[model samples]
Target: MVSLSRVPQFTYQKLVHKIGSVDVLWFQHNSLDPELLMPKALFEVEHTTDIQNSLLKFQELRWFFVKMFIVADNKRRTEFAEKMKYSAFSELRNNKRVEFVSYDQLVGQYNMVSAQPSVSLLL
Candidate 1:
């Protein structure tokens, strides 16, 4: 099972675009400025579906997220890497803005992050 945190609010297919729609858009909670309201993190999950489409969707919204995470199961992660264009994969490989994570990794991170109490609560 996948375990992602629900700590912050996110937009799901709320903001439309040409290719289709973003899977999940996570934003920072602050009143800094309207311009700063852009998503801090973008996520595309490909479990049993085509990772290509999910990747394409993230590519379309590359401007929105400061950091993007593409999630796939163990098998698909390798397959997606193999099927991707060399340049595209290189770009994905090079960009810190994008990351590819396996389901187990995600769950582990989620478990680690979510298990801790909020700083606000600690204060």
Candidate 2:
């Protein structure tokens, strides 16, 4: 099986809070209609950034993605956790599919997988 991750480059000029854009967006193509597609997941990288904006962007597109992730740095991770305590953000806190990934974890995972000598060539 061939799986690919599609990252959206175009700006979402239609969203209410058009401040931030999704860094990684994944989609699945229809077997019947080649042109028809649906979003599978989304990822936002927050390195020394605001969590509220990222959360808002994800909230707008939440219905489409089954899984969503917030990848943030150490400082941003703590900030995000604190910001997540709002009553209005209950949706995000209760969602089982949503995930938070720290920068250290992301780096460790990348390093672990790419540790092989041959992997460097592929990269």
Candidate 3:
């Protein structure tokens, strides 16, 4: 289950891009582990906001490449807290709320790049 404490109050301006994928296999394959120490919602949200805004100023195409994906481990709540320190994405990568779409028909044209949130502006 997702730890509500770690769920941040996502802001519109902070969201760079919104990725819409309906592939369950891809999520399962690429999903990172959950953190142990679930960070406070405030902390996660702030981090996410900072991460999002930071990526908006880039003009190069190479920024699109994902350097690394974070996965939380079995340390429980603490794991999440620890992961947050190293998270490199615009939003917190919590496993619980990680949207899982099994059917492409429900979403868009089955494309992975429909409305992806901007992720190229992180440090």
Candidate 4:
């Protein structure tokens, strides 16, 4: 169940406002609260945009429990590392709250997961 910008009866209104319009936001449906949803992760796909902007967005939502990922080409890994050194981003860096995922790695991971047999296949 994927939604864009908004989710039907989402429970995290405050969080959504704070996060603004992130590239992707993963959520899990709450069985106990069927009408509401909980955020699981946040992903920012920066193919050519400034990496610091995405980092700043993550910084603002640092206290939240959601995982944060910056997806870009492998060549940008160094830039991501270098930007993390700034004092404004120290806490997130030191705590390892954010991660960098190469575009290839992300696709590979998706492929690998997709190749897995469905649970129903065993039945």
Candidate 5:
């Protein structure tokens, strides 16, 4: 199994105060789909933090395309999603490539995550 902590390139995005929530973004990519993965990591974060921030160091990332995703599971997640929608602006209406799937959907792809968050990601 791949241990995230071992991956030196990965970093955490900053926390933004959009609504009433505090969100943290993590950058990741699918090696098989380098182009799509690279860009995905770019807009993944939009905040600044004392800890390592992924979005802030997007320039250092060397990949093809970009894709962004959110990671919030508590009461603040809704605000994060809303902020994403607001940020997309025109893309939200004109584009059809982006999607916002539940974390469960992601786990199902690998057969590692269940319907419940606690059970998913093998946490």
Candidate 6:
């Protein structure tokens, strides 16, 4: 279940399947019909926890259209690559169903977006 406290922007109640709790999930809602909402992306932030645990969760939800990402420290990129070589994760690796986002990359993106002026204000 997604916690409303984490995403206060969402006012409508959306249904998410029980694929275990993810660190962060982005949902796409139809503007015409707010009731129609679907998962757009899934992110797992692995700082101290085992990376394999996050991969296992992503493996189970690979069938969905949602984009999957594993966020971790840049130093762990090699660990991620090594784990992706495992036979069990062959499907995810071969198909490129998942991506890795380093903490620095994530923060950089956030900062870039924050630096941009709002379109509404510009208008």
User: All candidates' TM-scores?
Assistant: 0.64, 0.63, 0.16, 0.84, 0.31, 0.78
Query: Which candidate leads in TM-score?
Result: 4
Write one digit per residue (lDDT tens) for candidate 4, span 8-34: 445467767766578887777778886
Cα RMSD for candidates in order: 6.6, 6.3, 18.0, 4.2, 10.0, 5.8
Q: Candidate 5, which segments miss by more than 4 Å at Cα?
A: 1-64, 74-77, 87-89, 96-98, 112-123
TM-score, structure 5 vs. true: 0.31
Model 6 clash pairs? none
Residue 16 shift from truth in candidate 5, angstroms: 24
lDDT of 1 by residue, 25-68 (tens): 55554575644433556677877787777666666665554676
**Model 3 lDDT, residue 61, Cα:** 14
Candidates ranked, most accurate by lDDT first = 4, 6, 2, 1, 5, 3
- 34 Cα displacement, candidate 2 (Å): 6.9
The TM-score obtained by model 2 is: 0.63
Q: So what's the TM-score on candidate 1?
A: 0.64
Ranked by TM-score, the better of candidates 2 and 5 is 2
- CA lDDT, every prediction? 0.59, 0.63, 0.26, 0.82, 0.34, 0.75
Q: For residues 11-111, could you state the per-residue lDDT of candidate 5 as single tens digits?
A: 24321221112132334565876533222232232223321232223223322234434332344445544543544333432443223434554456447
- Using lDDT as the measure, the top candidate is 4
Candidates, ranked, TM-score: 4, 6, 1, 2, 5, 3
- Model 2 segments beyond 4 Å from truth? 1-20, 28-37, 115-123
Q: Write the per-residue lDDT of candidate 3 for residues 29-104, one digit (tens) a residue.
A: 2234343221211111122233333222221111332222222222323433443445552243432322112223
**Which structure is stronger by TM-score: 1 or 3?**
1
